[model samples]
Target: MRVSQSMKPENAAKKLGILLEAAPESFREGTVTRDELAALQADPPEWLATLRREGPHPKRVVAEKLGISNSGLARSGITDPLTTAEIKALLAAPPEWLVTERATQAAVRAEKVRVAERDKERAARGASDARRSGGGGV
Candidate 1:
């Protein structure tokens, strides 16, 4: 994407891989030059340095990393960005909430898989019935 001054703060933050909350107030307010954006991506400022250690992780990213849901993050009081270490610790020693959230995630994934398989089977059955009926297009 062509980085331009017209880009919004959120877009700039996404491009730089820093969270909007992690970026400085000035950065959040002003438009960024392409060069500035590139520089930020290449070498984030001191404030963003901590984001490097942890992240500008959004809710989805954080949840996926922690194997939890957005609500789970809230229940765990993880309202802020978490470092890789914190995520690792949670994984290494699963808490009740973490265990529960992981199960939920797993169940959601399994259901999606099952639904996809069922859809595929239905499609195949439809195709077979169409072939048997000899109605394979006029």
Candidate 2:
């Protein structure tokens, strides 16, 4: 006998681009098979399509669309999921908080790149020094 592969509802919801809480109770209570998940993505049902088009989007999606971080959304008191219209509205006329948060997020991304580059250089130097030292002993 072979075991069937399945994923939890939360994982399915993430893959489907909808909030787990926003999904129907029936969907929430059941596990999704890989085929079912793929079918849903390939030809989304009304609910999934609506959720993706009009959303109640997850924080990660919202953050990416808004060019900000999840923490920034929380800091701006946006605890609830936002619909597409609401996201567009913000983009059309960004508030002071959104402006500030975008800048902060940009700075954070830049710093991360800088740190990664520095770490890479350090690692390369260490490798070079190791090669020169010839394993330190015979």
Candidate 3:
């Protein structure tokens, strides 16, 4: 059966081997971004399954090894699943994926700062109201 585009990103990401822990920023912003797996459906189905059997980076290397264009991997609906060891290796030297890691960290920190600011603002508003109400005492 064919998967519909209406499927959620988190679900699609899982099928694509993403292991999403939280909602994506884009999705939270009222956009329906396709998960990596669904986006790859643009490619042929047979090719994607072939890549899954091969391994990670299978699209590029497997295709090269098989004498097919990398694009073929997308059509085949294949996704390279990351092992725990591989995840550890990538985190140890995240520099290889510089742009993404840095941007992710920055976004997280920004969100934290935003939350802190909001909390402070709310506290100030509460204090002002309390003072106006004569400390809520008899």
lDDT, candidate 3, 1-138, per-residue tens: 864345565555445543333324553343234543445656625544443443343234433433334444344443563444443464466543333434555676689999999999999999999999999587
lDDT of 3 at 26: 51
Top TM-score: which candidate number?
2
Candidate 1 residue lDDT tens string, 1-138: 964556788887777656788667898896877778778778777877777567757665678788777887888777877666777887999889888878887898899999999999999999899999998577
Note the clash tally of each candidate.
0, 0, 7
Which has the greatest lDDT?
2
TM-score of every candidate: 0.70, 0.85, 0.31
CA lDDT, candidate 2, residue 92: 99
Colliding residue pairs in candidate 3: 43-75, 44-75, 44-76, 47-76, 48-76, 48-77, 48-78
Stretches of candidate 3 exceeding 4 Å from the true structure: 1-79, 95-99, 133-138
What TM-score would candidate 1 get against the native? 0.70
lDDT of 2 by residue, 1-138 (tens): 866689999999998878999888988997999888989999988998888888999998898889999999999999888989999999999999999999999999999999999999999999999899996766
Superior by TM-score: candidate 2 or candidate 3: 2
Alpha carbon lDDT at 116, candidate 3: 100
The TM-score that candidate 3 achieves is 0.31
